[model samples]
Target chain A: MKLLKEKVMAEGIVLGEQVLKVDSFLNHQMDPMLMKEVGSEFVRRFAGEGITKVLTIESSGIAPAIMTALELGVPMIFARKNKSLTLKEDIYVESVYSFTKRETNEITVSKKFLNADDRVLIIDDFLANGEAAFGLARIVEQVGASVVGIGIVIEKSFQPGSKLLKEAGYRVDSLVRIASLENGTVTFVEGE
Target chain B: MKLLKEKVMAEGIVLGEQVLKVDSFLNHQMDPMLMKEVGSEFVRRFAGEGITKVLTIESSGIAPAIMTALELGVPMIFARKNKSLTLKEDIYVESVYSFTKRETNEITVSKKFLNADDRVLIIDDFLANGEAAFGLARIVEQVGASVVGIGIVIEKSFQPGSKLLKEAGYRVDSLVRIASLENGTVTFVEGE
Candidate 1:
């Protein structure tokens, strides 16, 4: 977590009061070595939870989720953002709003992947509005699966996502939590 | 490779004449152990290639690419399928047509991650039309980076992707090459 916070402080760019871009290492162009550490740390945090599957959204979340799945020795299922011809009609669907894209899109997972027996662990690159994690939990619930925990690489603690998910009865853990991003400077939450 | 082929044979669903969905292990829901084997196999095949970076498209390609990057001790960068607020104005962009989705999407990568000195190895889940590889190669070329080779999980040799890439003078390797998918029976190319 210290390594992540250090890398974030060194490379993270704040465009506005809301936008934090860590694409140089975290999301678009990934540092797999750092990601491996992040995965191991998540495993340590959520160990003994009987996590049967790791769930995430497509694109950005796939890398960290895959790494965590590797460490946990479980399959990682990412909900696809678009409806493709290859995807079957029988699927659990949820709509999520993206503040960056300023649009709402449907994300889905095939019913074959999730079921009542699955103890799902949700992972994502960032948790701000908490919509993506909530949407993933909704899909898991549709299959009668239990969400064991949620792991995030970075969390904007100033945002309401953490509180919202915690109030919804989900245990959420973030490696680096930004306390504030005022005037293009990032402030980390102490003791995170 | 045997493990991958066995997974494909057991869990792969043949939808039509050309569609083989191995979402159970290879894509949608990924078996991390098998993917670890895949990453090691790719490292064995491309050993001593001096690959500075592993490149791929988003969603499905990120998992294997991340694993491969982990094995190779290099960073992995996935091209975003759409423009986002986090991305900068300076980028390498290319248009790729998805046969399954029946649409062309613009993929972009930040100019900061790739450079002329970088030797990139492209990785992907499926190589059918080879459009994604070609598109990724175009982005690398835009940044003046050399594409050392291309690694694919499953190649539909029945299609023109492999042949086209080979003819284009890019070294392309697939773990499993399917010769035919006649009547829902998947046939592998002998000795591949």
Candidate 2:
């Protein structure tokens, strides 16, 4: 978590009061080394839980989800954004409202992947609005599966998503919680 | 490679004539252990190729790309399908036609992630028409980088993508190359 916070402070760019572009390493172009640390940290936090699968959204979350799955020795299922032709399975569906993009999109997962037997760990790159994480959790529930824990690499405490998840009675563990990002400096929350 | 082949024969569902969905292990729901074999196999195939980066398209390809990058000890950059706010810096954009979807979509990657000095290894989940693979290759070429090799988990030999890639002079290696899927049985090419 310290390594992530340090990398974020050193390289993260704040475009506006809301936008934090970390394409250099976090999302667009991934850093496998940092992701390994992220995986270890997530495992350290949620290793006690019996996680059967790692669920994540497509695009950004796939990188960290794969790392976590590798570390946890479990399978990772990435929900596709669009109704792509390659995947024809309509196993489960959930509607998520993205506060960052200011758009709502339907995220889907094949039912063949997750079921009631699965104890899932929802992983995401960032937890701001928490819509993506919620969407993944929704899919898990649809399959009658239990969400053991939600592992987030970075959580923007300024938003209400984290509180929303916690209010839902789910154990949400974030590596680095952004207390504030004023004056181009990041303040990380020290405790859960 | 035997493990991959066996997994494919066991789980791979051939849809109609050309579609082979391996999402059970390779793409949608990723089998992390099998992906390790894939990454290691790729490393052995292109060990001394001086691959500085591993490139692929988003969604399904990210898992394998991460595996290869971890094995190669390099960075991994994934091309985005649509315009997104998260992507920053200069980008190498290309128009890709999805044969399955019967539509065209533009893929973009931040230019800062890849450059002329990079020796890129293109990795993907499936190769039917090879459009996505070629799209990544084009991005590498536009930045004056060299593509060391192109790795495909499953290659449909009936499709013309592999032919096109071979004609274009790329060292294309597929773990399981299907000669045909007649009557629902997959025939893998020998000495592939």
Stretches off by above 4 angstroms in model 1 are none
DockQ for candidate 1? 0.87
Candidate 1 lDDT over A97-142, as tens digits, reads 9887898989989998898999999999999999999999999999
The DockQ scores of all candidates, in the order shown, are 0.87, 0.75
Question: Residue A119 in model 2: shift from native, Å?
Answer: 1.2
Tens digits of per-residue lDDT for model 2, A93-181: 78998887778888989888887999999999999988998888888988889999899988998888899999998899988888877
* Per-model TM-score of chain B: 0.98, 0.96
| Highest TM-score scorer | 1
TM-score of 1: 0.98
- TM-scores for all candidates: the values are 0.98, 0.96
